[model samples]
Target: MSNTIVANDLRKRYGDVNAVDGVSLTVEAGEFFGILGPNGAGKTTTLEIIEGLRQADAGEISVFGQSPWPRNPALLPRMGVQLQASAFFERLTAREQLRTFGSLYGVPGRKADEMLEVVGLSDKADTQVEKLSGGQAQRLSIACALVHEPELVFLDEPTAALDPQARRNLWDVLRAINTDGRTVVLTTHYMDEAEVLCDRVAIMDHGRILRSGAPAALVRGLEAAARVSVASGVMNADEARTLPGADEVTDDEVSLTISTRDAPKVVAALAERGALEGVQIKGATLEDVFLDLTGREYRA
Candidate 1:
């Protein structure tokens, strides 16, 4: 696939710290990419610089093989951005807000209405922006961003504080957007969201990208194996560690967590010992991989 974005040694500095230091990555066309990091990490800074909202202190960036440095006006038309907190005129209705935004690109009213339906906001097309729910408002923000039908779209913390159902609804909308062949670059602290929505992800911390790949691939690269946990009914935790492929066993009052390279062997042994009642065989997750690479847990 052709590369849509290529950033090389991108750096940004604040008073005494480098918010983004020597970051480099490439995003392919039609790919759903995600950037994952904690607060104060360089993820947001890197994203903003790529979006051309902030100038880099050093290095180069290109979107669709053209320079985005210094915030190109022509580039703006071919890319859409939905900031963390999208603002809208309270008095304007959803349809009016989209129309106003579309006018910036010389797009007509019909385009705005079509976008509202695309984001499932058509039912409330006449509702004032201030009266819309949080999810509705965010959907409208996304609709406005797509007024020009850009090829590349950037979404920053797309589901920051919405309820479970609202978040799921937005995920569906984003998936639909991607299905139409638009490249989506997402930044979110929610690991589950990235695991579900992104085809590939880059984990960043302390102004650098620690790792980048498919979510499942990154997790599979961890040295830690799947966990085979069961209630410590009759088998001693230490004895259970002697099972084939079992590396370590952590025991509590009622349960034992077996870290095993071969879960089948450990589970069968536990079952033979009549200790499989409360067993749970769980696999590694993106959070686990991130914690292993960064030496820290990802906190929202």
Candidate 2:
């Protein structure tokens, strides 16, 4: 399949510091791709370069077979963007804000009404931007980004600080966007969000990409062979650490994810120690891979 975006050796500097240093990656067409990193990791800068909102000091970028720099006319209308925090008229209602955004692309205002439904904001259509709650405003921002019906969409931390139910609701909306064949590029520090929403992810750090692949593949590439989790049982993390074939073990109170190359052997050892009651087995997760690669857990 052809790639929709290709960035090479992209660099951006702010005075004495490099914000995006020698970063390169490709995004396939119609795929949900995520840029995962902590704060000041160049995720936003790299994304801004691709979206044509910022200039890169060095390297190259191409989106949809055309250079994004120098303000490519053909690229703008085909793309949508939701920045870290969306700014609106504040006075306008959610529905009116979307309508105003649609007019920028020369599309009829009615399209905003359709987008409102897509984002599950139809109930708050008449509420002003300032009156809308955090979650509602976020959903409105996404709706505004997509009101023009672009082929590619950029969503930066779309669900930040949302309640659990609101975040899940927005995830469904995002899935619908991807299902319609719009290529999506998302930047987030949420491990579970990236694992569930992205088809492939690039783990970035300090202005560079550490690894890039499907989430499952990257986690598999870790030294861990299998992860045996004790869901409902409590095992002392220190005791489990010494179990046979256990290379690493993480105990989070009620659950433990034991990384081992030898699953049966590890299980036998655990059983011998009477630690198998209400336990479970599973594969390693993207979060595990992030910790192994960056030596820092994703916190957002």
The lowest-lDDT stretch of 10 consecutive residues in candidate 1 is 291-300
lDDT of each: 0.90, 0.89
Cα lDDT tens digits, model 1, 1-300, are 999999999999998998998999999999999999888788888989999899999999999888887778879999999999898976999999999999999898897789998999988999999999998988998998888899999999988989899999999999998999999999998999999999999999889999999999998888568888777766787788788878888888677888988889888887777878788999899989877877765456
User: Compared with the true structure, what per-residue lDDT tens digits does model 2 show for residues 112-206?
Assistant: 68889888888888988999988888889988889889999999999889999989988999999999999999998789999999999999988
In model 1, what are the clashing residue pairs, if there are any? none
Tell me, by TM-score, which candidate is best. 1
TM-score of each: 0.91, 0.89
Clash pairs, model 2 backbone? none
Q: What would the TM-score be for candidate 1 when compared with the true structure?
A: 0.91
Worst 10 residues of 2 by lDDT: 291-300
Question: lDDT (0-100) at residue 73 of candidate 1?
Answer: 87
